[model samples]
Target: MSAAGPILEVEAIQAFYGTIQALKGVTLQVNQGEIVTLIGANGAGKSTTLRTINGLMHPKAGKIRFEGQDITTTPPHQIVAMGISQSPEGRKLFPRMSVTENLEMGAFQRKDKENFKDDTERVFEYFPRLYERRTQKAGTMSGGEQQMCAIGRALMARPKLLMLDEPSMGLAPVFIEKIFEIVVQINKDGTPVLLVEQNALMALDVANRGYVLETGRVALEGPAAELKVNDRVRKTYLGEG
Candidate 1:
């Protein structure tokens, strides 16, 4: 790990959407080279926490840091420039844009061509399907293919940390498995990930550590293996009694 500390740190954050409170003092961390997952039921504030961290929604309270630098009040665009890139819940790609164009947009804040080329190559390496469809409009692709393009676009940012929200949503079982496998490979290749997913089984499988959220609070947290076997977690999130 860098002497700078965790790749991301969230301390007791509270968030609100209009009058509705979303995140209630949630705290978490993603250390260098680790995949940390946030798993919870619907309305448990999983996505809210990610939104708060990414600056799409600012926390009403608490602090956020990236690489030990305070970013609690950073603007969303600046936050992206600061090396935190997020592939949001909906694969919000530019529908009219080709796969390569979408990936290029990911590097909009970047000015270096050589590194951009390298990053695009790395993304294609991870998702060869993107390479095959490089010229196809993103909106015309299958859900799985679009998901890969979304992630590939995020990778083009060459983020110091990647935050993926619900990557497996709407995907077929086969695609889900493939996406999770690639997630592990990406983590292994050196980008720390903070994943917010409802697929607790798959999320925990790839995660190094996890936090379970309930009603906007952290209900449980531990190493992934421990959380996997926890009675409550198994019953609530893992579909077992």
Candidate 2:
């Protein structure tokens, strides 16, 4: 699962919406089959970075590469075919759709329909509560259940690289623990993760590497364990001396 080259690379990307700039010359990389995190405060442009990579947001300048192929200009749906999938900041489920229906949307680009069905069952294995509520409308579920559905939906795509934005946001402490544990399990099962999170402590614990973001750019980056013990990280993020 080792990436001979970076599975995803952002080279000096300057992303914007008209005159309003969100990311200023940001750059980072995610190695194959590894969990790499981007940690920052709100409005630090972390979510924008993930959106650009997934093609939800376009880059006004710079390059993005996946599996050594340039994908900076690829459309969102096509990007999915190339094996990158995102579970965005908001769970974004179809409120009127049943949990099963919402999951089916994730595999829309897939050619092997039968395998996609099997994959859905696998998603249930990981989040068994989803199976119990499969026929229920998505909007009726709790925050933690919705988060599980979002992640499970992304897995339906069988992506090579998964991008997750704030998977633990708004959950209770116990649910947050369950969510992080599921993230580690997903990574162990062979899909690389590019995680953008507010929960720096848990993110660093599960990740192989981490990048600290300030404003719209990478401020610091290193092995997760090293970052965890850094004085700056402790004082600012870990809330310690």
* lDDT values, one for every candidate: 0.91, 0.91
Worst 10 residues of 2 by lDDT: 1-10
Tens digit of lDDT per residue, candidate 2, span 52-170? 89888889999999999999989999999999998988899998999999999999999999897789989998899999999999999999999999999999999999999999999
Q: Model 1: which residue pairs collide?
A: none
18-128 in candidate 1: lDDT tens per residue?
A: 989988899999889889999999999998898888888899899999888999989999999889999989899999999999999999998676798788889999999
Which segments of candidate 1 are over 4 A away from where they belong?
Answer: 1-4
> What would you estimate as the lDDT of candidate 2?
0.91
Question: Which portions of model 2 miss their true places by more than 4 Å?
Answer: 1-4
Task: Give the TM-scores of the predictions, in the order they appear.
Answer: 0.97, 0.96
lDDT of 1 at 209: 91
